[model samples]
Target: MANLSLDSDELLLPRDVVAVDVPASWGGEVSHQLTFAGPLGPILALPGRRTRWLFLARWDTRPHTPPPDVRYWRDRVPAPTAHWVVRPGDALPLVSVIRCAIRTVRP
Candidate 1:
């Protein structure tokens, strides 16, 4: 959903592909701070293909420290709070696009 307007300008080409620039040559999670102008909240990318990234934190900036939330990402944990899957890409924009599409259809 996004605009479906193929304007090319609406394209979600992020500033970087992998989210964060780090020293992990082996390829790994990188945190990207996306301050959505709307209220969708901040996205933490444990990078992956498709909808792999989950909601890491709300817009409040209070760390998501719940054991369940942390456990879901325990397979790989680091200070960056971002993980990767398949390759590094922006996942939040994808989610936002989907949400926008759904809203258009539902409303």
Candidate 2:
């Protein structure tokens, strides 16, 4: 099992969500099993590849706090809360996708 932290300033706001594109193989298996961890606890497991967009957000408990939302590639999607880790699995490599996305964002 892998552990991810969601206590970063970048994820403090409700709208601060990260969108990760999870690619699947022809067999419908993913290269990794992701686990998201928030300040409270584990948010949710990777929902099967219904949508290529893996939306992520930070867990907020403020009253009436709006949910996390993102606009990627001209599409808007709701995001789940927290940090994530990629576990070993069979299929396409998702870590590379995530790393690439992060790299594009920072510097």
Candidate 3:
């Protein structure tokens, strides 16, 4: 489990609640992993892919604090690999974030 510590009012989403779906081919199955960070949400990565996606959850309610910005994510997420944030819901944001991350990393 993640060593994430949250305040009493903050939402600590379960593995299922924040789960993200990715291409099966990327890892032989669609799996989710939580990246321990601030309010930036979960991180998704594939072994061969040069880019990773940072998913943003709605928290199902208003949070005591606002979510972190992209700069915060870029600075904290792992280096060498590119990262992008994907807001919860439909496939559009997922695809768009993937494309954007690819574009940013491909040079």
Candidate of highest TM-score? 2
Name the best candidate (by lDDT): 3
- Listed per candidate, the RMSD to the true structure in angstroms reads 14.7, 13.2, 14.9
TM-scores across all candidates? 0.19, 0.23, 0.20
Instruction: Write model 1 residue lDDT over 1-106, tens digit each, in one string.
Output: 1211112222122222112212232112222223232323223343323223433221222233322112222222333334323232222333333233223333
Cα lDDT computed for each candidate against the true fold: 0.27, 0.29, 0.30
Off by over 4 Å in 2: 1-13, 26-75, 78-97, 100-107
- State the lDDT of candidate 3 residue by residue for 43-95, as single tens digits: 44422353333343322322232222222121123333322332323322232
Query: Which residue pairs show collisions in model 1?
Result: 46-83, 46-84, 47-83, 47-84, 47-85, 48-85
**Residue 56's lDDT in candidate 2:** 38
Candidate 2 RMSD computed on C-alpha atoms after optimal superposition onto the true structure:
13.2
Native-to-model Cα distance after best TM-score fit, residue 100 in candidate 3, in Å = 14
The lDDT of model 1 is: 0.27
Model 3, 20: alpha-carbon shift in Å?
2.4
